[model samples]
Target: MKIGVALPQMAPGYGPGTTVDWARRIDAGPFSSVSVGERVTFSNPEMVATLGACAAVTERVQVLANLFVLPQHPVAMVAQQIGTLDQLSNGRLEVAVGVGGREHDYRSLGAEFKGRHQQLDDKVAELKALLAGEPPFEGADPVGPACVQPGGPIILAGALGPKAMRRAARWADGISGFSVRGDAEEIVKVGELADQCWAEAGRTTTPRKVNGCFTALGVPDASEALHSFVARYLGFLGPKLAEMIAASARASTPEVLAEILDGAEQAGCDEFILVPAVTDLKFVDVAAEVVAARS
Candidate 1:
C-alpha cells in the first residue's frame, strides 16, 4: 500500500509557512502523495492555492485535491484549475470530486445547496468532456493548457454511501473514502460496496480502493488533541453531533496509527492518506517511521 499525508491546511493555526514546509517535508519523505481537502466557508486556505504550493515544491509525490466540492464551484472553472494543476504537478495530480455534506459552505459560496446531487452527477460528465478536449459548445474552442496526463488526472469519488458509489462507478476511476473512526471493517465494507456498485454499473475495470483517517500523533495528550480537532472541524454539525463524532476518533498515538495502517492495507487500500490534527513537523517524521516499519 502507498502512504500519503495531508498538508495541514484546515487545522487551527495553519498558515502559508506550515503549508510550504509540510509540503517539502512530505515530498522529502517516503510518501507517495500530498493531499489537501476543500472547505471555502472555513478558515482553511483555498484548496487550489494550497495544492499549487505543494505542486510547485514537490517532485516525487502525486498532489491531490482530496475532496474538491464539485457542486460549490462552476464546472468550467474547475476544469481549468484542475488542468493547470495537472500540468503543474507534471501529471502527478489526482482529483476527488464530491458533493460535500456542508450546506452552509454551499450557501456561503452563492451556490445552490438543493439538487447538488443531481448537479454533481451532471457536472462530473461535463468536467470529463471538457478535460478530454471537447469544446464547451459548437464553434467554441476547447479549454487550453491541456492536462499533463494524457486523459487528465485520475478522478475519484469522495463518496461513502451506496448511492454515491453507484453514481461514481460511471465516471470515477476510484473512491477516495474516509473512515471517521479509522475502522478497518468499514474500509473493507467500502471495498465490497465499490465492487458491487461497479458491477451493477456494468463497468469492466475494478475501482481503485483508497482510504483516509484523521490522526493525532506526535503530541502530548494526543487523544484529547484529536477530539478537540474533530470537534472544531465538525462544529458546524452542532455541539452534540460534533462531540459524538469527536469522541469516536480512533487513531491518536503512534501505536494506534500503526494498527490503523495495517488494517487499511489488509482491507485492500491501494493508498492511505493521513489527515493530521496538528501541524508539528514531527507528525510527518513519526508517520514515516510507522510506514517504514510496515513496509
Candidate 2:
C-alpha cells in the first residue's frame, strides 16, 4: 500500500513554519501523498488554503484534501477551487467530499444540515460537469484554469456510512475513510461494503481504497502526548467526548503503528494516510521508519 502523511494543522500551535517542514519532508521521504483536512470554526487552517500552499511547495507527493464538507460551499466555487488546485499541483490534487456531521460547523458557514446528503449528490454531479469543462448554464462559459488531470483530479467520497457509500458509488472514483478506533476490522468492514456497493452500482473496476488514522509518536512520552494532543484538537466535541476519543488513539509506539499498518494492508488499503499528532520533524522520520520497516 502507498503511505501518506498529514500536515499537523490540527496540532495546537502548529502553523506555516511547521506545515512547510512537514510538506517538504513528506514529499522527500518514503511517502506517496501529503494530506490536509477541513474544519471551518476550529483552529485548524482552512483546507483549500493549506493545500494550495502544500501544492506550491511540494513536487512529488499527491496533495489530498482528506475531506471538504460539500454542501457548505457553492458547487461552482468548489469546482473552480479544485480546478485551480489541480493545475497548481500539476494534476497531483485529489479531493474527498462529504456531508459533514458537524452541525455547528454548518451553522458557522451559513449552511443547512438537513437534506445535505441529497445536496451532496446533486453537487457532485455539478462538480463533475464543471470540471469536465462544461458551462454552468446553457450559454455561460465553462470555468477555466483547466485541470491538468483530464476530467479533473480523482474524487473520493469521505464517507463512513452505507447510505453515503451508495451515493458515492455513483460518482466518486474512490473512498476516503477514517478509523476512529484505528482498528483493522473497521477497514475490512468498509472494504467489503464498498465492493458490494460498487457491484450493486454496476461498476466495472475496483474503487480506490484508502484509510487514515492519527498517531502521537516521536516524543519522550508518546502515548500521553497523543492523548493530550487529541483531546486538545477535539476540544470542540466537549471535554468528555474529546477525552474518550483521545484515549482510543493508540498509534503511539512503532509496534502499535506497525500493527495498524499491517492490519490495513491485510485488509486491502491501497493508501494509508498517517495523520501525526506531534509537530516535531522527528515525527515524520519516525513514521517513515515504521512504514519502511513494515514494507
Candidate 3:
C-alpha cells in the first residue's frame, strides 16, 4: 500500500521554516504523498499555503488537502485555486472535499450551516464543471487555466454516511475516510461502504480508496499515549468520544498499527495517511520508523 504523511500543520511551535523543513523531510522519505488539514481555528496552518509550500519544494510526492470545507467557499474560486495548484505542481494535486461539520466554523465563515449537504452537492457539481473547462457561469468566460490533468485533479470526496457515500460514488473520483482511533475494522468498513455505493451507482471503474489514521508515536507507553491523544482530539467531537476512547483502549501499540495497516491494505485501501498525534516534530522520526517497518 502507498504511504502518506500529514503535513505538520498543527505541530506545536511550528513556523513556516519548520513546516517547510518537515515537508522536505517527508518528501525525502518513502512517503508517496503529503497531506494537510483545513481548520480556520486552532493552530493548524492554512491548507493551501502549506500545500503550495510543499509542492514548491518536493519533486515527486503528491500534495493533498486531506479535506477542504466545500460548503464554506465559492465553488468557482476553489476550482481556480486547485487548477492553479495542479498546474504548478505538474499535475500532482489530490483534493478531498467535504461539507464541514463544526457549527462554530460555519458561523465564523458567515456560511449557513443548514442544508450543508445540498450545498455540498451543488458546489461539487459546479466544481466539476469548472474543472472540465466549462464557463464559470452563463455569459462569463472560463476563469482560469484548465486543470493540469484531463478532467482535473483527482477528486476524493470525504464521506461518512450512506447518503455521503452515494454522493461520492456519483460525483467523485475516489473516497477519503478517517479511521477513528486507528481501528482496522473501521477502515475496512469505510472501504466496504464506498465499494457498495459504487456498485449501487453501477460504476464499472473502481474508485480510489484512501484511509487516514491518527496515532501518537514515540511516547513512553503506546496505550497511555493513545488514550491521552484521543481524549484531546477525538473527545472534541462530543458524541463520538466514548466510541473513540474505547477503541483507543483496545489497540495502542506499534504492533496494532501494523495490523491496522495490513488490514486496511487487504480491505482495498489504495493509500494510507498517517497523522502523528503529538505536536512535537520528533514524532516524524517515529512515523518514519513505522512506515519503514511496515514497508
Q: For each candidate, what is the lDDT?
A: 0.90, 0.89, 0.79
Which candidate achieves the best TM-score against the true structure? 1
Q: Give per-residue CA lDDT, model 1, range 194-276, as digits (tens).
A: 99999999999999987998898787888888899999999999999999999989788889999998899999999999999
**Which candidate number has the best lDDT?**
1
The TM-score that candidate 3 achieves is 0.91
Better-scoring candidate (lDDT), 1 or 3? 1
Residue pairs that clash (backbone atoms under 3 angstroms), model 1: none
lDDT of 3 by residue, 191-291 (tens): 88888999999999888999877766666675665565555544447747645664654344667777777888887889998876555656667667777
| TM-score of every prediction relative to native | 0.98, 0.97, 0.91
- Per residue, candidate 2 scores C-alpha lDDT tens digits across 1-295 of 9999999888877865987888999998999999999888777888898899899999999999989889999888989899899988999998988988788899998999899999999999998999999999999999987899998888999877899899889888889998855799999999998988999999998899999888987889988888888888788789999999888999999899899998999999999998888788899989989977876
| Model 1: per-residue Cα lDDT at residue 28 | 93
Each candidate's clash count: 0, 0, 0
Range of the 10 consecutive residues with the lowest summed lDDT in candidate 3:
243-252
In candidate 3, which residue ranges exceed 4 Å CA deviation? 219-226, 234-236, 239-253
Q: Candidate 2 — which pairs collide?
A: none
CA lDDT for candidate 3 = 0.79
